[model samples]
Target: MALVASLCNRVIVMYAGRIVEQGPTRAIFKNPQHPYTWSLLRSMPRMDEVGKERLVSIRGVPPDLGKLPTGCKFHPRCRFKVDRCLTEEPPLGEVDPEQLARCWVLMKNVSNPEMQS
Candidate 1:
C-alpha cells in the first residue's frame, strides 16, 4: 500500500468499500488527517530507519465488510478515536480544495494550518 501510494499522483484510502480520505499523494503523506491514513503510513517500514527503529504496525484485524461496526468502521482499531467516532459516521468534507476526507476531525476544522485548502 505504501509503495502504491508513492507511485500515485493522488491517493484514496478506502475502508469497508468507502473512501476514508482522498488527496494529492504529497499532501496526504505530508499531513494525513484521518486516523486510518496516519496508522497505515506509520506502519510501513522505512529504508532510512531499517536498523534505527522497529517498524510500526496498526493493531487489530480489518473489519468485516459485511458486518462493519457502527459509525466509523475504523473506530474499533483507531487509537485516537473519540466518543463521536464510535457513533457518528463522518462525511467526506474538504480538507483543502483538492482534498476530501471522511473524518469529523477534518470536517470540524477545514482551515488546519498544516493542510489549508
Candidate 2:
C-alpha cells in the first residue's frame, strides 16, 4: 500500500473479483468512499504509529470465489452495511469529483464512530 501510494497516481480497489472503488490515490487514501476501502485502510499498519497503534482487522471471513454472495459481495463483512446491501448490488457511482465507489451506504453519509477523529 505504501508502495502504491508512492508510485501510483490513481488506484482501483477490488473485492470479490469486482471493482469496488477507483480514484486518485491521494483522494482515495485521504477519504475512502467504500466501507471495504475504509476497513482496508484501517487494517494496514502505519509505520509512524508503530507499536503505539493496534492494527484493526476486518470482521468475518472472505467469501468463497466459486459461490459469492448475492447483492453486494462485501455486505456480509462490511460494518456499514444497510438492508439494501443484502439484496441489491450497488453501482459504481461517483462519491466525489474524481472518486467512484460501489456501496449502498457510502462512508460520507454514514456516521462511523471509529472515523470520528
Candidate 3:
C-alpha cells in the first residue's frame, strides 16, 4: 500500500475533496501518530482486547467529495475531536520520526513506547 501511494510524489488525501492530510507514505504510515490514526488503530479489533467481536469502525459514512464541508472535514466522525475541531481545519503536520498527522491531538511531540525499532 505504501509503495502504491508513494509513486505519485504526492498523496491526495481527500476528505470531501479537501486535502486533510498529505505527505510521503512512509512518513505518514510509520509515524502517523495522528489522533485519527490512533483512533483508527484502536477501532481495529485486536485478539487481546477481550470481548472484541470485530474491528471498530469510524462512526459515519464518508462525506460526498463533491459536497465537501467547510472547516475540519473529520469533525463529525472523529472520536478525538475537540471544540476546535468543529470550527477550524487542522493542517497536516509532521509529528516527528517522519510522521504526518492531520489531527490536533496526535500532532504534538511524543514518543510511542510500543513501536519497535
Best candidate (score: TM-score): 2
lDDT of 2 by residue, 59-80 (tens): 9999999999999999989878
- If ranked by TM-score, best first, what sequence of candidates would result? 2, 1, 3
Give a tens-digit lDDT track for model 1, residues 1-117.
667766899999887789999989988887888877876787788878888866556778999888899988888887666789889999998888988889876533435422321
Candidate 1 ranges beyond 4 A from true positions: 1-6, 106-117
Per-candidate TM equals: 0.82, 0.93, 0.57
lDDT of 3 by residue, 1-116 (tens): 43554575644345555555556665554544554554454565555767845555667887777765566787777655668877778787665544455777663444552331
Best by lDDT: 2
lDDT for 41 in candidate 2 is: 96
lDDT of each: 0.78, 0.91, 0.58
Runs with alpha carbons beyond 4 Å of true place in candidate 3: 2-12, 36-54, 65-70, 96-100, 107-117
TM-score of 1: 0.82
Error of 1 at 99 (Å): 1.3
Reference-based lDDT, residue 3, model 2: 95
lDDT of 3: 0.58
| Pairs clashing within candidate 3 | 43-56
